[model samples]
Target: MEGFVQNTILITGGAGFIGSNLCEYFLGLGNKVVCLDNFSTGHQHNLDGFIENPNFKLIEGDIRNIDDCNLAVKGVDYVLHQAALGSVPRSINDPVTTNDVNVSGFLNMLVASRDEKVKRFVYAASSSTYGDSIGLPKVEDVIGKPLSPYAITKYVNELYAEIFSRTYGLETIGLRYFNVFGRRQDPKGAYAAVIPKFVMQLMKYESPVVNGDGNYSRDFTYIENVIQMNELAMKSQNEGAVNTIYNTAFGERNTLNDLIAYLKKYLSEFDSKIADVEIVYGENRIGDIPHSLASIDKAKNILGYNPKYSLQDGLKEAVSWYWDNLKEK
Candidate 1:
């Protein structure tokens, strides 16, 4: 990240979980960060820590608007497009809004980045892009038909990024994230991810629900590992690394049952009574897949990605954060 002091990076959705983390990291590295957010899905408190920092600036805008996208991309060295309506059920309920924000908004960013001639355009792809393939340990290539509206939107992102790269000659990198979780992940919404939701439920002594038989598995990735992928994608000097997608994951899989077990074990450290909390079983969710796993070989071999945190390592940190920062709320 050295020599990045001269860089002015625009992080769309800068108030959201993943984007806020990017803003914090870039600011710490002495980079100028312009955070463009609508606050529709992103929280304001995530920016409270760095709001007054000289290296930081916030633009209250949505990526769905080209004018807003233009303003944010102006005078930027790199664009990290993380703003999107995430969640399968949410998209299933309202595919129109999802397409507008994810697909249309992504196009806006690409056009703005191309017009501005930014060095690179990196984006958040999803493991759901491997939908219906029944492939174990998904690779960068060989994807299946999308299973949900959200999945289709994410797949379109990869396709657009590739076309934008070839046609406009803009450098683009797509990180196909597989079930990412960590600090700042919101647990209040109806579409909250399983990890954060379960963590909070356990903290309150509420019975966490395990959809189906609790045997479904995922390649749950940590936030720090995602940050590593973003940094490498932005700074890679390798010609082969540009304009391709990489699986940003821990390269391992664990079941939902295993997830709850870890949550109970870790939470009990702070409150012994939490060890007795029970989990409730529910019917399988609509459009839910059985398992998701990622093969990180392409990322490791191409982008030089080395994941430092295992599921256990990340869960320890995440559990502690929820306990200290969100416990009283």
Candidate 2:
């Protein structure tokens, strides 16, 4: 049954948090995996466990290089392009580099995959692409202006992907990830996501800083749900799923205050010390959307997407992983 999967699967940026999880999942299903990464933003430790897997191959290369893209795509049946410069503040600080990697690198991979005649090209899009579209439960067809460079780059990916499918006869699926978090997610770094950053701060007995009012909310999706979406996007039989973008989220929203309270409660059980830590509220970040939620009806209906983990359920699992692996360190 496992052999029915496309044997040769190429995952660009395969060592990053979500990419690494996808690599492990598809490989476990008995597919030969090729992981291409430059390690600029990804860690080597992400792929350390899979290095010895006979069916897995790692190509230490950059997506910015056309030859590297060509080399990685050779004989590959499916391409999961996940490499991108993420983070709104990082893009605000250095928009040029973000555009270079997210836009240019993305196009390079698209060109190479089309030329290689891959069966499917599924890439990571972002909820940021929704930008200033103030509407709750963001749908696919409508989008507002891109507020940040990172947003621009991601929106460009959908544009290029759509063009390739129409003009060059390629199959492309875009998954707009909303705040994905899980095991193997790096909690250290200035650019770390909210979950990891808060976990790290709580473990060190430091106050977790909440930007703006703490009432700001997000539709925080779990990493395992994203892995399911990617696999389903790459393997779906419905023609409607091709050349389309789907919001990959758990369809739930949580305010920063609610999230902080939840985190504090969970961490306190491990060390009784975190129970006393205070949360500091600061000025809101520029270019940050005040609230975000996703309408996952399209994905559920078209791709048979069923998210198994809700926020509380996923956080229970994730916080436990952090407790075991990160807290002691």
Candidate 3:
């Protein structure tokens, strides 16, 4: 991160959990950041802390629109493309909207970046790309058939990125994110991620439901580690690093039961009654892989990426943030 030059960066979905964090981080790094979001899944309140900054600009637009993509990428040096309809169940329910945003929107951004001659295009890929592969620790080279529409869309993004890199000479890096969770992640929706959603339920002394017997595991990554990978992908000068995919993860897996235990432990600190909250188990949802763990060796060796947060470390921070910022509401 040292000796990195400041440049104007465009973050699609800049008002969502991860995108908003990127916006705040890059703005703090003395770079001009233009945020483009349609506010469908992204919340406007996520931009509150830094919205007034002169270095930050907000474009109320959607990535599905080519003109909006073009207008946002104009004069931008880097594109952190994170806009997409994310959720296995939601994607199952509405594949069309998911494809329109994840696939078509991604293509629009790539075209805009190529046309604008942006320096690099870093995107938010998903571990769902690993799909039905039963491999314990997933490596970049291998993958299985996608299990859901959401997985299909993310894999398509990677393919499109590689094609754009080869066919258009654009610099691209795809970060295959695992089950990412942290502050500002929405905890209210039916499609809300498990971590934040469970946290909210426990805070209210309600039973947090587990989809299965709670043995399904994931490489739960932290937001800060994700930020690190994005920055490294943008600034990496290594010849072999660009135009490749890297697993942006903590390289460790935890089961849902383990996650619940930690969540209860952390939340109990704020309210002792949270310790008594029960967890309910239901039928396993469709299109869910039994386990997911990342092999980050490629990212570390190629991009010099080192994730600074473990799950417990990040959960502590996330729980604290929710307690202070959201528990009252």
Candidate 4:
């Protein structure tokens, strides 16, 4: 990962979970990093660790504004476009705002990157683009009708990236992230991912709610794996790897019951009472697929991606972080 020469990298949504992590990692590699975020769903505290770093710069702005996009991309060598409104239910409740931010804002970033002549534009795509497919392990070439407004926006993003790559000769790579979880993922949101929310709940000895039967499953990727994929995308010189999408995941699936059991097992190490907490089941979520898995063979063969953590391994790390950071608060 350190083989590439130092270059300035611009990460939009740099105060969000994945964005902040990328900012820190790239800065650690001796690269100048510029963070552009609006603080809508992103928290400034996410940048607390490296806010004072000389190589790190923060610009508070929204992606919906073209000027903000242009300003963020100026003089940047690569753009890791992570700014977007991410939530299936939230999109359903308000498709207009979701589309405005995810689709329109994505276009703004693409244009800015193309105009600035960035070497590569790596972005956060979603597994929701596989919507309604029912395929066991989703591949990039195969996709179905998007199930929700959020899914539509993500699929549209892939299209826009492809067009920009073809029509304007802008290098682009889309990473379809699975359920990513780790340190600094906010657990106190209406649309928070299940792992953090459940960990926080179990920390307080409260019941963790399952939106459906505990059989529904997902491929939960860790933050470290995602960080590796982004770096590979930004630095890879392989021509075939450019202008395409890769599934960024550990390539394994676990049921909701398995997740809860693992969470309880890990958290119980810090608090024995967590093992006694029960899980509550309710109606299935409206836009959620029954199960999701990813095929990382493309990432492995092309970009040399070898994820180091499994679901259980990542949960242990995440649970410990929550215990150390959020338990006392």
Candidate 5:
């Protein structure tokens, strides 16, 4: 909290789910927040609360444009680079655009932050960067070749961050987020994560199709845990911690069936009929891993990280938010 005082934080994709949460939390702590979002995947409704805040300013700009990146970085003390087109399927369809935005645009942000002399640059990395590596619990040092265009972009992000820190001496931290989910995570999109998608389908009494026999598991992280990681990365004075990456997750895994069961059970609390929704099994998605789990040992030891919400704890809060915020609308 004391770290945010007199700090000006530039959250690149501030209109998106994770970035907006950062904006809200930092603004609450009396920090000046400047949000830059092209709204490619982010929504206008996400900014409804922050737009009116005197401490929060939204920059309606794209990261691909170097001028916009430079402009947003000016007079900023720290940066949380969350801007990028996210979605494996979308990248599969348009690798060029994904590379341009995720890779080239990330370069732009690094350059801007370096030139502007921001104290620290923390970015939203992906667990997909772990790629096709065979391991039960993913560690920071072990990674395999990327399986898809999206994964490649994310892995390249780590490379660029490493290069920037090594060459330009820009302080940096990368949080490899695993299956981040919670409020404002767009469920309407074709590439929506399983949790919110299932929640929406069950709410409408529509059958939620499992991408496989509901056996594929993932480290479903809550948005609040993500926010905590970002804050720790931003504030930590640990010399060894800076310029490194950390796994931002709840340290547990859940199968797709468990996701649906919880969604039905929780949504049923609001509407009893939701519990009756049937789940349909389907083919597993191509390029999707069979299971994913993270070792939070690095984050815990280095960044002083402690995840406050587990998958179930997060789902309860998330379900309530969706019911109150999106269900009625």
Candidate 6:
């Protein structure tokens, strides 16, 4: 069965890495797409290929502006809310800005979508929502106190989304994404993810820094899997689907040390000079979970969510992409 869907989909932050990819997938299926982005954290070049597409409409706007959101959602059928200020370090450094973009911006989008009578409001939640919970496989009902301002914002999103659905009758779905990585994911900047950072470092034949002892484990998800969850969440018709959240991950875990080894091994084939590069370690940053493993049974049984790529498989694809695009540039 087709997922809870409509003819035209409104995707906020449509120029970012995940948003752009979602735009491509939905537009490919002959759906009219309205992409709203302010280009604060997202790049304009990310949506270059789709700007001319007849099914795609680009609105240069910010989610912080309720007027912009209302205008963008006027005739939207489904809403995919992917815009947010990401990174715990960034949030720790500038909590107020993060709260404004992630919390205030999220609430504004929800209100706009509800006012526009959108069919489904799907949002990008974070695994950081799990926060200080020490559970091996995190469940939706179970959560710990948010450790970072960023985590608090995401958890607050879920809370607000739940209330909106109950009071305002807005149907909402949240995808709590794990460590997502893949093509078009930005590798530049201080708060870049470990994979992309390592890939860039390996390209320069430089040692990549490992945070803490490198034993910290994470359920590193691929961008494709994340897109799948978003698609499934938006289209799900089951009554149990709405006003809920799901873990979008591979149901597998990997450590930083292992990830580094994999990157070095795969990247070394392209340039033998990277083979001998050593790794440096530093203290673990605050707001990071010690270990993360997702029980995908909820997503698997409910949404038919099937992640086709393993950690190694996803990394290989990401490594190749970085080698071709990032290295050349």
C-alpha positional error of residue 80 in candidate 3 after TM-score superposition, expressed in Å: 0.4
Instruction: Please write out the lDDT profile of model 5 over residues 188-239, one tens digit for every residue.
Output: 8788867778777877788999988999999999999999999999999886
**Residue pairs of candidate 2 with colliding backbone atoms:** none
The 10-residue segment of model 4 with minimum total lDDT is: 1-10
CA-RMSD of model 5: 0.9
Name the runs in model 2 displaced over 4 angstroms. Answer: 1-3
Error of 3 at 61 (Å): 0.6
Q: Residue-wise lDDT of candidate 6 within 1-329, one digit each (tens)? A: 25433389999999988999999889877889999999887888888878899889999998999999999998888999999999999999999999999999999999999888999999999999888889889988899889999999999999999999999999999999999999888888988877898899889977888889999999999898998899889888766888889999999999999899899889988998888998999888877879999989899988989999889999899899889989955
lDDT of 1: 0.93
lDDT of each: 0.93, 0.91, 0.95, 0.94, 0.91, 0.90
lDDT of 4 at 69: 93
Counting only residues 3 or more apart in sequence or on different chains, how many pairs clash (N, Cα, C under 3 Å) in candidate 3? 0
Q: Candidate 6: minimum summed lDDT over ten consecutive residues — where?
A: 1-10
lDDT for 316 in candidate 2 is 87
TM-score of model 5 relative to the true fold? 0.98
**Can you give the TM-score per candidate against the true fold?**
0.99, 0.98, 0.99, 0.99, 0.98, 0.97
- Per-residue error for 260 in candidate 4, Å, reads 0.2
Give residue 116's lDDT in candidate 2 (0 to 100).
99
Candidate 6 stretches with Cα past 4 Å from truth are 1-6
